[model samples]
Target: MRNLKTVYLFELSSLLKKKAYIVTTVIICVLILVVTTLPTLQSIMGGENTGEEGAFQEGTFGIYNESDEITLTHLGEKLPGVTLLPYESEEALKEAVLEEEVSSGYILKSSTDYVSVVNNVAMYSGGDYLMDSALRLVNEDLALQEGGHDVEAIRSIMSGITITQEEPIVLGKDVQNNYWVVYILIMLTFMMIMFYGNNVATYVAREKSDRTMEILITSSDSNSLIIGKVLASGTAGIIQALFMGVTLFAGYRLNYRNYDEEILDFLNMNVDPMLLLVYFIFAFTGYFLFLFVYASIGALMTKVEDVPSATTLVTMFVMAAYFIAMFSLGLSNESIILKIASYFPFTSFMVMFVRYAITSVSLFTVAISYGILILTAVFTAFASVKIYRFGTLNYGNTGSVVKLIKTALKDDNGR
Candidate 1:
């Protein structure tokens, strides 16, 4: 216990004193703050807000209607709230787009054909699709007129039957509302684990390569060394992550009302406090478990260059857990696969919390899942100490993690 405390405090203090760690944490928090406040800044600068429902209101388009059959009034009616400037020729329409006089231009060849001109295509540009829909409506009207049919009468007939919900349908939860929240959290967890987990492995490998491990192991027991290292590294990572989360939440609150209404669905910052607490718990435990494995992997490497290769299997497992959680997001809480994953320690760290956040979950179920994860983490930490002890001194050709574990067990039994 004394040795564990000394190691934990020393490792933690060493990590805190590093310029790279402190600077990286500050930079990330600053970025989160700046990104969250961007909407407010844009609004203050008088930038145009283009939302889905009001997209047409934000830009102007040029039109050269060569087809006398298609009137400006009909086109205007099709695209409500859009400004259409008429051009004398197709060349003029194209020139208007090139000169930035309009967002885009259209030259009507006939009721069925038209040419669109734009200076550049945007990632989310749907102006051409909107124009196509409007042109299609105009062509249909022109065809109906040629057939001697009343266009308004046909429109009224089509618009007569509309469906309306008599009452609001209630469900256990709304997946769409909570999806981005879980997605962001999952990504945050994955990155922290991958980055800080590697930090642990690399640190151990560096110590081994420098002959520091030979001196340290003689002074301290392997159990104390591994436990203290994992605890200290996990604490540092959690501190950085928590600070960033606080920065994001603070920025969101400071600029809450400045955000576009449509964007509120995905950027909704009204997360439940209880859910956040549960996420922290799972994330902390999962991080601690992974770091111990990382530390053992680090002990197995004789050279610093082998760190990446040694950690690849653990990285793959973390990625698999990430993908599994993402895939299961849209599934029902009672899904057979989700039910199994929520209890399985390897996946429960993400799956269980996701279930609790987006849907209804019992306290008993959460307790059971958490208990399993805690036990697994405890067991992994003890087992990793054995591997760490064997591998740190063995410094020879350490095969895979599986083979190392088996050999470590045999060596321990021989003792």
Candidate 2:
């Protein structure tokens, strides 16, 4: 035990002494700080006031008139942000949407129930929302005019269905401010972990390919060496995350100073500091598990050229897990796939943290998921250590995956 401790400390000290590590850390910290501050700076420079009227820019819409009563002249005057271009046929409007002459335009069919809006672009661009809202307004106005309903009567009916959406008082403020910061923080944490976790694996691979691992392993056991390196990399990643978080917080304060009370109330309710700490712990543990396995694969490679191919399997797994977590946000925790992913070592860290942050997750579930993660991490660490014990001493061309596994298992049995 003492020998293991000695080895761990020695490896950590050696890493600390390396100038490259310090330089890389500084570079990453600077990058994170810059990236975090840019958005706030842009917001300040741009100011709160927008020159554009409404959410979207004014665009020409091609209105295909099938009925003689509905003319573009009256419709164009009624709509505020749209310029109506009269098209004789639906084909012409469809061609316009396809040809990029128009962002999006609608075809008013003979049937009153349906108005088809051509949306080639993704929904995020705000074009889809604008088109849908405009079409609905036009339909309502046409209906009232056709029915010969009095303007006052139409207004009364429209005003009768009052939608009172009482914004939930969160942290003494409204829901909008409450939810945004928490969501951003959660996403940032996940990204940082993934970024640095890959770095740790790559670092190990580079050392192995350069024949530095053998020299380092001579003075340190694999377990001690891997733990020290993983810890150092994890610490660096956490520092980057914290720097960005602080920068963002500062930016929010400076930029939104006038709205301080509302912001504070929103943050106070949604941003749980304890949740961040738990997420970090889980992120580090799950990341280390994958890093260890990745390093083990790296050990089987003979050159830096081999590192990419060797690590591709792990990369795919990580990417899939990342996408799944992102897609599963706001979904029920009891969802079969999500529940299974929450307990799966590869995905548990990101998915479970997201699930916990967005919804009310039980402490028992958190504990159980983390417990499984810890056990898996320990097992991976031990297995990788045994593999490194043999693989570092190997010479010549890289061994086959089967041979590497066989040798690693054999080394474990011999130990």
Candidate 3:
């Protein structure tokens, strides 16, 4: 334990002082700040993208809606970018438009089951966007009528359901861009695994290539040294992630303070603090878990140049799991591959992280995945320790998998 602490502290301090690691950390922090604060900067610069730039002049249209108990006046109140001029009679509505009292006229031809939008010009660009929304609202109203729901019940339901999901069963309306946020988080998690995990292999390969492993192994067992280095490298990654996360949160807060409704209509930085905590924990564990594979690969290679090719399998697994998580995260009936990933330790980090984040996955299921992941990590680290001698003392390619397996077969007799 004392030896491990010495090695761990050495590795941590070495990585923190390395030019590559420091540069990468600085770059990531800059990226987080830019992504989080861009909307606020745009608003300040009068370049915010609210999609309301070319919107029609407000309060300019005449409305004649006589489909149900819902009056034209009520519907007009809902339309944000345009004004609806209500009339006692359709004649008055049409006459006002023709006489230039209003910009144009709308006569909703509705039925017990259908809603259509008609216009005077026969050419309405923005009208489609608005009418599509109104049509969805009308359809939802018709759906609730079958259940014989009262006004209060209907209003309660209306408060949540929008045009997109007739029923968002897994996530609520309050979760704006839930899929997007979680997907980005998954990618970020994989990025950390790739960047820092690759560094583990690189560190091992560097030590071997420089013949530093010889002196180090003389002082300490290879397993303890490798484990110590991995622990330290993972600690550095956690520190980097925490810094990036704090920068994102701080930028979000600053943006919110200067939030302009017209500019920030598309900006909602309201990430659930609970979700952020989950993301950080998953990223920390997942990156550390991936480091074992990388360290093993590093121990296999004789040269630092061989690190990337040696760790190709790790990259492939992470990419596959991320894409699968993208496809299956919020689906009502998740894909079979995702279920498989949830059980497999290699893929569970991403698949299970997304499941718990966006879906209705229970805490118990994620806990089980965590158990499998930790066990796999331990097993991999032990196996890496066993094979550490195979390539570290050797001087060339070592043919990785085949040679490592052959060497493992002979460790008892050969030594």
Candidate 4:
């Protein structure tokens, strides 16, 4: 027991002292700091206030129309920011537009023709939202005139169409907020699995390739050694994750003091704190399930170089689950694959949380999903331990997963 504790401490301390660990931590901290300072930096750079200074925009449009029915006053109401100046002659309007005295011109070339709008820019560009709205209104007015409806009748008909909502719709905000949570959850899943899961695999493989397992077995039981190291790696990862979380929280508060929204509070629109906690716990379980499986696979490998090839399938499987969760979102919450994925342990880490976040499910359904994941994780962990014990004893290259498992089960050394 004492030797296992010593081994656990040595493994964790050795990893913590590595250059990769230290540098990665520092880079993450720096990124958090940069994110914290972005708003302040933007404010310092003197950004544009589009709404307040809207009137400062140039370009007065000249109009050539001999209509007594339409006036600049009617057009001004439809087009908020445009300045329309009337010219009696088409030639005068054209010359004004060319001289840049007026930026553009709208001419009724003939009574039979539609209004022509032109700008002097070298390449034709879609101007702005206001311009598009103005053009649509002008076309509608012209069409109504052709239909023998006056401006007053058109206004009456348009104003008669009203929107009535019994309950205010917030479905968009709910989905958007859910997406924000899902994105953060996916990042957490990737980090945990890539760092701690791969760490367990590589650690086991390194010992095997180094022939250090012979010495390790002499001091402690295989179960104790594997469990202790798994615990140590998990503890180390949890500590680093907590530290990063705290640092980010502090940076967020210090950086965005003036900002009203916080990540936690921002997502409070649809999900409750308890539900989020459940999501986090279930995700951790799924990670643990895979981490131990990775360790067992590592035990089978005779060389460190074999880890990537052996574990590539598992990595791809996890990645596929991530993509499913990513695409599912609010748009496909009711999908058959997503529904199946939510109950399965390998994918529940992301799919379940995402589905729960964007859609509503009963408490009974959550309980069943949680039960299945817990059972799978517990079973896979124990089964992996037996395989780990046998795998460490077998030497040379492991050809296939089936052959390795067959040999492990046949070996009398396995638990």
Q: What is the lDDT of residue 56 in candidate 1?
A: 46
1-415, model 1: which lDDT tens digit per residue?
4499999999998998899999999999989889988988888888746556666456888999998778888898888768899999888888899999999888888877888899998788878888988989988888899899999999999989898879456466666666788888899899988998999999998998998998998899877888898888988988888898799889989988887776776675566777878887887788788898899888888888899987888898788778878888877656777778888887788878788876788788899999999999998887788888887768775567678777886795314
- Selected candidate, larger lDDT, 1 vs 4: 1
Go through the candidates in order and give each one's C-alpha lDDT: 0.84, 0.66, 0.72, 0.75
What is candidate 2's lDDT per residue for 1-415, written digit by digit as tens? 1256665455466655678766866676566556545545656676432434644745667677776555566555446676677777888878887886776666655424336556565655655455555556667777877788776677678789878889565432222332464456546655655576566666776787788898877776666776666666665556555665676576555545434344457655655675777677887787678767776766666676666666766677677667776666545434677778888888887777766665567889999999999999998887877776666776454456656667766864426
Candidate 4 has an lDDT of 0.75
Best by TM-score: 1
Per-residue CA lDDT of model 3 for 224-325, tens digit only, reads 788898898888987887888798788877777556564365555566676666566665666777887788778778778888987887889888888888
- Local accuracy of candidate 4 as per-residue lDDT tens digits, 244-349: 8888778877766434344336724565675687678888888778888789889999888888888887887688778888888747347889899999888887
In model 2, how large is the Cα lDDT of residue 195?
A: 70
After the best TM-score superposition of candidate 4, give how far the Cα of residue 293 lies from its true spot, in angstroms. Answer: 0.8
What candidate 2 gets wrong by more than 4 Å, as runs, is 1-53, 57-77, 80-149, 167-198, 208-210, 217-223, 257-269, 272-278, 355-361, 412-414
Report residue 185 deviation for candidate 2 (angstroms).
6.4
**Which model is ahead, 1 or 2, in terms of TM-score?**
1
- What root-mean-square deviation over C-alphas does model 1 reach? 3.4
Error of 3 at 393 (Å): 3.0
Candidate 3 vs 4: which has more lDDT: 4
Models 1 onward score TM values of: 0.86, 0.67, 0.67, 0.75
The lDDT leader among the candidates is 1
Greater lDDT among 2 and 4 belongs to 4
